[model samples]
Target: MNVAHFEGAGAPPRKRPWTAPGALVVRALGNAAAAAPVEGAMLRFGRGRPGDPGKPVDVTVGVDDTKVSRQHGLLVHRSGWWHLSNTGRLPIEVGNHVLQPNGDAVPLRAGVTSALISTADRRHLVELCVNGSEGASPAPAFGLHTAPGHVWRLDERERLVLAVLGQEYLRNNPRAQPLARHQAAAQLAELRPGEDWDVRKMDRVVEAVRLRLSGQGVFGLVQSDLPQPIGNLLSHNLLTELAVTTSSLTSADLMRLEGAD
Candidate 1:
């Protein structure tokens, strides 16, 4: 018996047909859509009407989201090469790049390589060979540029997602507290209340609890202040942190700390 495999069977064969060396063309659809500057939408809901002038001109990468509006400003010199600053209420994600060109739609040619970001998980997925384009369809905002270097257009939703995720990330990160216990408790209480109001009483209550749990490592569950789900998450997170500290620190290390001592 004889078996044979085709030349491109083991791997995707390259098929570059009049394609640019390292360029990507993305359609202004999904969350990436935005209205053109003048007669354009603040958000690209979907589909555009005919005879719309001052359409979101094709923009290049490197433009900031905040500066995308007031085109006359960012477009300082290049009149033909339009620019966009992310103006949407959304966050400026370091990832997530899209390409949408005007006039003509071009599919990624066979053997061409590019990365598409998953709108759901925010992960890179799908390396394709022989991707096709239906040609430039009407898009509120689109981009034509090289692959994976800079991003220009960022929509509002995209910005929001990034902001929320970033805040969550920072919330989870641990930090060392150089401040004394009294000073640290004062700061934490301040974050929850107003300067004009009476915060000292509240601070005292927290300090009492902080003292009781100082060495035992059990911060009493104060169910009165937390929403059920948030409380659960907070408790889970705090306990996890405590477990790590318990495992990593020696009794001497805990004793050396002024307050814990």
Candidate 2:
């Protein structure tokens, strides 16, 4: 008996994510879904009731989402990445946390993305995507604060996760955006050894941390008001509420990361 094998049947290299310039995409994440601004230029989103006289914005939202203001949000391409800023009377959520009208900007990634913003009445689910991360890094924010009664701490992998989140991919780097699961897994894999962690466990890691924070009586997760992804909520809380920036892992934690303990 004989068997035939292809000489070049080896696994091909993983293809890198590439992006086109001046491209940003947005989609609705709620019951009724849609995309706006196309994905090529700067655009604005607004709403007009059935009888409102003003011209519709770049993306004319239907009267269904009354929460969307006349000029709800903006999509801008700056520095090296696409930025989403809320310019309406209400907050524009990019993920776990809502972006205040005058709040820090959140960088958009590629493909379909979901954000929850609200109006005087209800919340709206919207999505914005970019071609890819394209090496986009957020401005790093590192801080440590301790009071007589309140204190925050980070474990080993959490430190690494925050480090990846704080990476500066955008010029105006606002707050640290949570890393994608694969990105977090890759970054965590580099930081620690001996405990082979898989990307599959990223949610567990983040959720555990979230539950721990909840145990500490932290209400930051409620900011979104909607039960959503844990990682985004946790990252937003850590950066905005707890200020967990930089690699907070100390020598002891570093020992665990190096598996020298």
TM for every model, in the order presented, reads 0.19, 0.39
Residue-level lDDT tens digits of model 1 in 1-261: 011111211221222321222212222221121121122212211122122454333222212222222121111102111222233222222112233222111222223233332233342222222222422222233475554532222243222222221222223333221233344345444443443323354334433433444344343234432233332333333222232323322233233332321
What is the lDDT of every predicted structure here? 0.27, 0.49
- Candidate 1: C-alpha lDDT: 0.27
- Residues 156-249 of candidate 2: C-alpha lDDT, one tens digit per residue: 5665554444343111244446557687677676666556766766657666666777676655544342232333654555544433322232
Backbone clash pairs for candidate 2 read: 109-130, 110-130, 113-127, 137-168, 137-169
In candidate 1, which residue ranges exceed 4 Å CA deviation?
1-18, 28-51, 57-84, 87-92, 96-261
Per-model root-mean-square deviation over C-alphas: 21.5, 19.6
